[model samples]
Structure formats: C-alpha cells, structure tokens
Target: MPRAKDLDTVAPDDFLNSTLKSPLPPRPIKKPQNKKIKHLHQSSNGKSHSAQFRQNVYGILGKTKHPFSSFLVKPKVFNFRERDTDEEIILVLRRHWITNLTWILITLSMIIAPILLTTVPLLESFPPAYQFISIIFWYLITFIYSFEQLLSWYFNVYIITDERVIDIDFNNLLSKNFSEAKISMIQDVTSTIIGVSQTFFNFGNIQIQTAAEVPEITFEKVPNPEIIIKVLGQLRQEEELENIEGRVK
Candidate 1:
C-alpha cells in the first residue's frame, strides 16, 4: 500500500459541495381540513355573527344546555312557614264501594220491583194509569237514590291534610257545610264498629275530640275506622315530638 497520509488527502470544500448537491427525498404535503364553527347568538337580536364572517346565523350554535345559568347570577332564598312538630294530619275518605252501595241497591230494587210487579198477571190487571204511576214512582225512587248518593259523595267527603282535618257535609246538591280543625287540637280519637252488619260491611264511625270550639268531630259510616284512628294516633305522637323539639329550639 502507498503511504497512509498521501492516500487519505481530502478537501473540506469539495466534501461540502458534494453533500450540498445531493437531492433530498420528497416530503408528503398535508391538506388543511374544514371545521364547523359554533357560535352563540345575541339574545335580543336572535342571530349570531361569526368572527370570521358578517352573515347572521339564524339559530343558536353550541348554546348552554342549562337555561338557568344561576351561577352567573346571585342565588335567591324564599321564606315560608314551617310545619309544627306537635301536629300530625291525615286525609280520610269514605270507602268508594261503601259510598256506592246504596245507589247500587236502589238501582237493583228499581229494576227488579218494576219488572216483577208488571210481569205478574194479577198486578198487570191494574189500570194503565196505575201502571204509569207505579212506573213514575219507581223512577222517582231511583232519582232519589241517585240524588242521595251524589249528595253523600259530595258532602260526606273528608280530607285529612298534614295541616288540618276537613269535613264536608252535603245535605243536598244545593246544601253544603264545611268544617276543619288543626291536628294539634285533636285530644281524643275513638273508632266504633257496631253490630254484625257494620262488622261484616267493614264500616264504622270515627270520633275525634278536639280542643277547638267544636268539642267532637264524628265521621260516620267510614270504612276501617280503627285503622284510621291508629294512624291518627301515630301522627299525633309524631306531632307532639315535633312540638317538644320546637319549644327547645
């Protein structure tokens, strides 16, 4: 081999020129992607304009899902009366079936009696006027039954709300009386189911003694008066506890 120093003689200028002359590999060109812009419209104008454009957008874009943005505004507090702890109130109503029973029986009687009387040969021998009067009487009886039932359903209705007890008495369609008492006033509750008829029928009366002007409130011919009395008692106890706590507070 020739002398090492002579064989490796290289110029920096020539090396640089060779490197600069070499072609670079082609680069991939990336295309720009179109994106949708969301804008909120001014509430007064009901239209929104994009920052990049002057055209008004008809509808809201990306509006907040919650309409009540209360965080952006001051919160408000409302004042209301709190319930007394020593009072428990409940709603009571006559059983639907019991209330409707009189109507059902009357209707059955009206239908059966007329048919039985008119179909009998001897009864049919009565004058046409008598038959007409009998028919009228039957209709009258049915009307009376209907009227009574409607009156009872309307007036005899009792509602026990948390705050008070309400008694409604409808003597006729035209006559009505309403009474109410606070649960705190309730002193005594009595339930009575008298006779085999009432026991079998599951109907009875509930009597309430109160501290109010009205000494006693009686709910007549109500269903499951015992259960109602028990519930009322429990409510009364709860109310008493609440009252004691309230006094302490």
Candidate 2:
C-alpha cells in the first residue's frame, strides 16, 4: 500500500465528477388517487341515504314517507296546539304496513260477503221484507268494520318531538291510550326485527327504557327500528349537550 493519507483522501475534482456522472435516483412519481377516493366516498354516502328511508310506512294513505303530511287531518302549520312553542316534531311514525294487513283483509271480507250471500239459496228463500232487512244489516256491518279499522290505523301514531316521544293508541271509538316520555329521561334503547316479513320489509319494534314514570316504552311494528334507535341516541346526546350549555328549551 502507498501512504495511508493518500489512500484515505480523494481529490475534490474526482468526487465532484463521480457525483455528476451518476446522479441520485429520481423520487417515485405518485399518481393522482383523488378520483378513486371521491367515487368511493360518494357511493357510500348514497347507499346510506337510500337505506335510511327505503320503505314508506304510509304506503296505503299516500306516496309520502312522512306521517304528518300523509294524514288527511294534517295541520297547516307544524306546531300542534298543546306542544311548546320551541318543541318541533322530528318524526311521526306509524306501525309498518304489514301490521295493517289483518284489518285490510277483514274490511275486504266484510265488503265481499254481502255479494256472496245474495247468490246463496238461503237468502232467496227469505221474504222481500226480510231480504231488505238482511241487506241493510250486511251493509251496516260492513260500514262498521271499515270505519273502525280505518279509524284505528289513522289515529294510532308514535310522535317523536324535540322534547319527548309520544305513543297515541286508538282502542275504539270512545277509548284511547296515550303514553309519553321526555328525551332526557331515556336511558337505553333496544331494537328487534323478528319474522320473515319484518326482516324482508326492514320493519321492526323499538323498546326504549326510561328513567321516567313509564320505565319502558315499546314502539311495536315501526318501520326502520334501527334508524329510530340511532336517532334517539343522537337526540339524547344533543339533549345532554344542551343541558350542559344551559340551552335547554
């Protein structure tokens, strides 16, 4: 070996020439991935939107998904008389359309039975006076069946407001059941979707446990019970925040 100093030290010109001849590798060019990400985000958002209101509970009444608008006795204004000025109706829910099938079948049978009876030999044997009376009785029964079933369905509703949740049940022409609980009083929520029809139609029941007088409130056969549970949770969180900020209304 020559001098150690000579071996260890290279000329500045040689080092400069080596770097100039062999340049450092270029950094990998990144392709634009924004389009792919944007497309995915949009599709996810669309799916969520469509799933939220997939089926309308008021299909018999109208095309409207909203219960308030579908009602024949809908108010011109949103604010119902007894509700506070600040209270707003977040949602008005009715039992799923599947639940009304029983009443609908009964009404249809009541309507068709009269026509079927007329063709029977037993009705033909009756006197004119008796036949007329029979026809009147048949029609009266039909009317009552139709009226009662329709009235019960139309009046029975679950109202969720900013302040509370109300369950209005119409038992008959003269009797009704009403239950309500404040939003803040709600403690837990459970949703159940049992039966093939319920699973297929995406309708279910929501059971809410509360700290109020009524410990538990069940919303039976309601459409989109999972979404309702999510909404109740969000509403409770909001109510809690409002209370903390002293903005309770």
lDDT of each: 0.58, 0.72
> RMSD of each candidate?
23.7, 15.6
lDDT of 2 by residue, 56-144 (tens): 21232233435443222223344444577766676677777777788888878877887888888977888989988877998898888
Return the top candidate by lDDT: 2
- In model 1, pairs of residues that clash are 85-239, 85-242, 86-239, 86-240, 86-243, 87-239, 90-160, 91-160, 155-170
* Model 2 pairs in collision: none
In candidate 1, which residue ranges exceed 4 Å CA deviation? 1-90, 99-103, 119-137, 245-249
Clashes of each: 9, 0
Candidate 1 lDDT tens digits, 91-125 = 44654355476678877887778777767889767
Q: What is the lDDT of residue 2 in candidate 1?
A: 42
